[model samples]
Target: MNYMDNKISFSAYSALFNNVDNCIFTRNKVSNQVKWINKDDNDLNIKIKNEKRLKRILFNEIKSLYNNRINRYNLEGFSRINDEKIKDLEINKFFLVEDKFKGTSGQYSVFPRTFYCDKCGDLRVFSNTDEWKHFDVKNCRNKNCNGKYKQFNYVTFCPHCGQIKNIYPKCETHGTKYLKLIKNTENQKYWKVKCTKCGEFIDLYYSFCNHKDIYNLNHSISNEKSSKVMLLPVMQNSIFRSVVKTIVDVQNLEWEDNVDSIMLGSYLGKFNYLFSSNDNVNNPERILEYITTVLKTFEPHKENPQKAIDLGIIGPNLPQIVSNIENTITEIKKNYFDEEFTELTDYLILKNYFGDNKGNKKFTEYIEIHDSFKREFEKLKNILKISEITYIPDIHLISSSIGTNRGVSTLEDNYLNHFEPHWKSKDKDIFKVYSYPFETEGIIFDLNKVEVVKWLIKNKFLNGDEFNQFMDEDEAKNIIMNLDKDGEAYSHLKILLHTFSHIMIRRSSLYTGLDVDSCGELLFPKSAAFLIYSTSNINIGGFSFVFENSMIDWFQDVQLDIKDCIFDPSCLDDNGACFSCLYLPEFVCGFFNGFLDRDVFLGKTDRYCVGFWSIDIN
Candidate 1:
């Protein structure tokens, strides 16, 4: 056989071996008849009984190609044995194992069945259902075999729910006693069950029923199609090494004395009007002004309370005034503090970006900056050495904490809390879940940017005493611990970069004909790099076109966009983001819209006055 054929045979062998091993490990005795046929000799049928012996034989067979590192597959955290175990193991009527390497042009079957041609020795597998029985005779590949095939009817027990039944039942809501098995264009099998009473369609149970094997060989084969059979270790090691290097790089920078310096802190105890007013207050500004006026009148009472009280500067109605202000603010907050986007446009935008992408292509780009902010642009250019790149996007599934850890409460807590059940339940693992794919258009920022930012924080932005006051040793230690483990933390530079990325994503979406949720951002604050890109399934070609056609215009527009917000002045004075501005859909954002402050990007707001844009070059 050719080398390509040999690799395919080995992959199939590995898959089959893993499946048998899984079946045995689960103590499934019903489907014990596992067979492996030799490609060169059709008469040779190897009945696999001892899984350990089979592993040794297979390991020896592939050892020459993979060296002695074949043992890596058995290691904890890397092996199929460590994967989630299948709750139930039931043998269908029959299982047919096919030799893909030796098979004739049309001999191999998509699923396992009991049909074995007596003349050609070609085995055809089908789903052990009534619908499959009707097509079994017609599916035989050998034309001269006279449509002869054997069928086996064997009963098996379900490992999950401990049910021993001939057939899985459909939802009772559907009048049909059972679901009908159907195949899509991809040849994937699923049971179609529609509930006429409720008009509800359910696919989840069907997927669960079809993929019963703990080690799904079909899924393994499909996943391995894009990967090298022998280079799996090399790829895994490369990723591990890159992550280690990033962590080590961060640790090495710790020697810079100002590493522990606090660039920003949560507005917890600080007397900020933003946190003082509750959601019910329609106009926080007016209430804040009134409070300021009331406080100023108490200035004389600060030194001489009795004299001021006698003068009516302090009165019997003081407590009533305080209660009235507090109640109004509380009522306003209770009414208006909502995280869910009110408009259908927001939902459509989110769906466009995160919903299943039928087409397997996506394009993204960095918008150019305007000439007016040329100085800030130059600084950014210097920090991130921009370059063109081309590569497949690496998509990842990530779960994040719902609420912000900064002590400042947000409307997201109420909306996102609903997902807590799904997060905990294995069955309903859909809500608040997100898939993020990286864009090739990214830059590796200059390390000097980190040093410069650190220097600015230590020397120019904050005094030693002020820095110490904000820096919490225990909190810093906890952050470092999290960084070492998961590479996530609330570093000053990270917050700055994260905030900047949000502004860019929001602005880019508007110009690129994409929704703000369609655009996602990746921040590498440790490296001072951030990438903003499209998260849509199909290549809209809008971001790339916008960058190419109106790069300067896009950047100029972004600068204008971030300079002011619809809820501005108030948004600036408060937490620095709102539904009308930086907050993005849960799917597109990594941080869950936490640690965002536009003032950190624009430097125009009274709060967080020190910003990258405001940094003096001299």
Candidate 2:
């Protein structure tokens, strides 16, 4: 009956370490279920009202995780949740519950209360927690039997209903009251629960139920018999999969600056040729050019009649143009004054990070590393497909789990066990979604867009004319950023950058002192960049240590791993990613171990695939 202290970290609430109303596998002990109850004045609950960009995106993602019949996602404006007593409640807010716990401390109860006497083999179920705790100290409940008790290690999980409970097998003649649970050491699949009085037994591995949820879901339950219910170990790791959305603080900074810079396109009325990379619109000289031209409009007599604009004048509205340009520019510069940070502000911000202006610019958070190692980095940048390598040390990564799924890994449509704990006000109808903040070091690896377009062209996934469509780098960059996130171009770029991030994390783990599991990847697919940063909060001068000591070495050693995979053609299913090579732990990847392709870098061995290195840059 030995066990580790029942303790959990604050950060764990936002991660898989421990979740609200989920079971946790205790060391040398039966699994315990824990949950968080929302309180009005609970000081321990840190209100997560910051990181608006991350928050809105996170909310949209969580909303999408649940299969609402109406589908609240991508609905032009913010979703107005009309609560109808359907337990899902309204996802209007969030909070970070940490520190000395309030609701969940020592509140864990023994799960799968069905325990059996190893000697007598009879089942004992406990419906009362206090009585169970009192009698748990003693042995077998049978008279004159002092057999050691063993908690049933398995439970029935109703994926659709999102409920877990001990399996109760009943017989036609004699009920489950006299049931005996039996486990065969050779195979767990053969475990069974039998009626001692009738000798009739039912396999525990085969279970059933009409899976339903607290939410009034209108979706039809699966007719597929196997999917009706799942039998799994009580401590199975896949019981809960945490769904979290993260954005680097640097991305937040660039997101605001870049969005403002893009807005400059509307003011100049330069929709004909939008500026792109290098933020040409944000260039001081570029700003001056527009400013000097606009200032000329202030001249009274000098203002030419052809240029004299009025909103009422159909042909040339100089007055309206001048006012719009001035206000837009002034608003753009004021972005520097923002002090508060947020995760998500609106859903529009998720699909359109550049051109969309619905989100409030109430946050600022970054530094780019290059000048110090410009010469050394030039070579790294010269590496094939390496468009740019920005060393960002001590990055602020704000991440939070929006919800979790059971009996499945992804936030799929109609999740089986979607558990999103509501940290809402007892007095109000608001629900608080929590997030955990970590300061870590990272490196941003951006793939060359031109080369990617060329590769996509080679793969015949994109039109070849697109490469030369825009000569101005700014215009091209603008078009690229403005492209829909779910479009073909973004998907191609996302897969390439995601795969590159995985390989780099593996290589960085070997060269740097950081463990692979200690790192996390945040991908900026639109910009064709991926960041590999530390997840462990105890930052030991995180990425700088790697950047200063072993960054160059990482690039050198990457080719060695990418050259070949231990499980070659077999690993080709994922386009060349397997655990033996590019595969990474689930935590390190932000996209839930998806959108990876070694073919993006290695080129399909048997096909006409133009990988990152397929084209010649030397």
Candidate 3:
């Protein structure tokens, strides 16, 4: 017989050989040598040719031996034996003996299988080979009710100390304490122990009972658990609705080209399909159930049963279970499908910012105009006067504020923490920033016509000697030279745009029926553009309506408002800015309300330096 032709049959025979005697065959270093070790310390060595005939002969001999033993023993199910009975048995030393006794398959041992009759509450141990073969189909042997047997590992605890008895045997803290089985009021069996050290009764059985009661436990164990569970139902509903809304929003977004929209639509379709097919995605109850099941299996074995009960694992601790379920789902989503899901999620956020007609237009125009503007200017440009303007309506705005308590604002902080030079810098050296989440309706103001900032050294508009007194001539020159050599002009443009953005936000809020605190600014200094918008948590379209209908009035007011401040001469002289003039709400200003000086835009009152607008004369 060809080994290849009868490979499937031979594989079945090999499995049978493994299950019956817990013996495995292996090839020795020398060719044609086969070695077998049985659970009874019996070893069989056979030498044969490297042919199918010899292999079949060896297999048949092993099978015959196993069958003879089975006939003699006539074993049924699992047989209980004392430790001394298996002393000479060739058990695999590396295999966990406990796992074998639990009726789980191990590297060695056979003729012992354990199962519990769920309905009859009867535990059965089978020692027969035929019983193991038919274990799954067996029914309860108890009288009056025959229920199918469920495989379960029997757990026992020390009556004296409540520690797991079989595993620990002797507890160092409590000495040798043997567990005695006792019955509860319901006649259900349990293990109990009393600690001799303190004469305190430790109820191991009660802990197991508590673990079983998790399905019905009502009270929450912790505040965090309560909060998470309460939020789970709401989060589940919100997440599904958000996914659907995102899909619809992606569909309605006016892409510049059909191809981009089509590609995005295709991706959204996949996301929708994935969510729809997974029933658990929107089912908080199902997620909670899964968490409970996993906790029962793993947590009970590793943690104190009472602790698990307290966590609501053996009870209705909805919040704790909800958190676990949420974490599990998040991990599954991340690992599933190799990060395509995460990419789609990021794309959805991108669509939210740039999906509308106004957003699309502003984004495209900014790109086109910035590229042209960068090449035209030798140095950074500042707003001199508006030559042309277009108002994009219904642009969404998001703003956040940060303070010292909340650490640095991710949106505004620029200093690198990991940079070696800056690592030693103190918090006082930087502005204290914090961000509060805010969202609102907004507008985009498109502009054309530009004026470039002049080199600070050549500007003789005011008192040069006074300017040098404040900043060293060499430091000022270096700042200007660095702007040219390393393209620091971009930073100058950002400062100009940022300052102007604050002015517009302040002025626009005054006329646009919004408070200065409610208005926010988004700066695109690299593009030499900025947008002033609303940042109220509620989406009131008042600002967008004003920009759409009365933009000319808003623009005129902004220009007039920035010409001078109520605190000017002083505001312009001392740091060139103040709360009455330059500073808006921290949320409205992007750079933690720092790095602003009206003199950068408007020429200084004392004419110590020329502004960007003043450079037009030279």
Candidate 4:
């Protein structure tokens, strides 16, 4: 058995880099269309930090892809996503491959399959089979031709159905086989394809191709439909949108497993600091104190703590809430697993807690307020209207891309739906996915809850009555999170944080020497904060390094950059954003660069200074 081995980054194997299931590939110095071997190696499997939620999200994505397959194959038995437990069988064909891969194929050919011989001026189109043996030896079919064959770097793409086709010559005499490629100008866009026999040529271009003629795409159209196919360079950026989803290795604290009693106790511990002084587990009176302290923080329950408790509002488990708190609170000190807060609820509760349970450097986070240059940090945080500047020394991320979005950069739903779910072969179906692991260091800027609400209301993105009832940060966060989609405050907060994150990334890139895209942002709008960190596989000691050494410089540069865009008067005159001011690469910006406005950062360039990051804070 012959084996071919190749080395490529897991990132390169993604559809983003063009080595997808049916796309053309450039191996060594030669290029050919490719298909991965229908088998996967377990060694290639990597785990995302939050596998359960990751599985749920990926199941939806893969299921959509499998569903998109044309129905005529009678490809029934599509399994529904069972969120109860995401087992191996759920992702059977998903191959999470690493850096290197090996496989053997029955046949591989230069895509377009069209070649030109300079010596005899003959153009030859090879068949998909091995019948053309002489071409394999690096020579042309013309009897007296001594020149080597050269492949064209162009192919035709169907804008309608995403089908790729080989270029065909349009001459009557020699048809496609005896054509010659004539370069009319230095630019290939002006080049022409000619038939030597007829002395006739047409510009290398896009035209009509019958959809039914494409080999495997069967479900979309009838045999009579013809569509205009665009001629694109093989490596053009628009050919595919690599559908990779990168998520933080978020840690869920099993908050749901703890019922109402222990829940109230946790709230008491975080809000009232009850755990520090109380040691008696069975003391009945301290339990009331814990419940009362927790209730007083809520406006509706403050006037009647025992009434809410008796009415089964706070801890429905009754005696269990008190007993579980006594038992579980100390277990955290002895045998409990380490805790790392990633979710908004956990971060919201614990970040406000003074109890000292934030875990180590590896699990979830290690956050300490940015106080290196106390004065500058205070000024920057105040100007940015953020309450805390958390510096996490280590951050880990898992990212995976499936399928290919062809013909446009806009990733339409149907394109994502077309990713192959499983390789089908007579009970040999196996799930495969390619996942890449990245580790780096970064920081999170927690916005002031009060300021966020004020900004939202001022911009009319939020109603004053919405969050007014909840003064406690935790209560406000819960209410904010549970609000429906029309609650414009939730989305605008994302925009404010998203736009703020881009400014930091663009500024940090200057210091770190990484492309702005190499940095990724994760917005916890519910928490009113965003985590900006290195997305690159390599860890160059990112956000923390600058935090320790040059945070002031970092803050200063960001302010100067945003204050005056080179496209100023015009850009600020518009939405307060343009490419020159705040736009990031399409894939880099989490929102597809939507909801961004420099006005969010600079507020109004008008007489009224009403922006969140506006320098005119009174």
Each model's number of backbone clashes?
11, 28, 29, 13
**Model 4 weakest 10-residue run by lDDT:** 359-368
Candidate 1 per-residue lDDT over residues 1-618, each given as its tens digit: 110121122222211212221011111111221122122223233222222222222222222212212232211212221112211111111122355554421111121233344344343334445545355443345565564443322222221211112223245574332223232333222323344346555441321222122243343311111211111111111101100000000111211221111000110111233344553433323333445565456545656666766777688655455455445444433432111111111111111222212222221222233345345445444433222221113222111111111111134422211111101123322211111112222111222343334333533343334333344434332222223211222354566667767766676755677777556565554234455555454557665556445444555655566667898679878877777887776446655577687766556655555555544443
- Model 3: how far residue 479 lies from native, Å: 18
Clashes of 3: 29
Residue 238's lDDT within candidate 1 is 14
TM-score for each predicted model, relative to the true structure: 0.32, 0.70, 0.31, 0.64
Better of 1 and 3 by lDDT: 3
Would you give me the overall lDDT of model 3?
0.36
lDDT of 3 at 115: 47
Give all candidates' CA lDDT scores.
0.34, 0.54, 0.36, 0.55
* Model 3 weakest 10-residue run by lDDT: 239-248
Candidate achieving the largest TM-score: 2
TM accuracy, model 2 = 0.70
Overall local distance difference test of candidate 1: 0.34
Q: Distance from true position, residue 75, model 3, in Å?
A: 72
lDDT string, candidate 4, 458-525, tens digits = 67666767666346665555544444433567766777888888888888866666678777777777
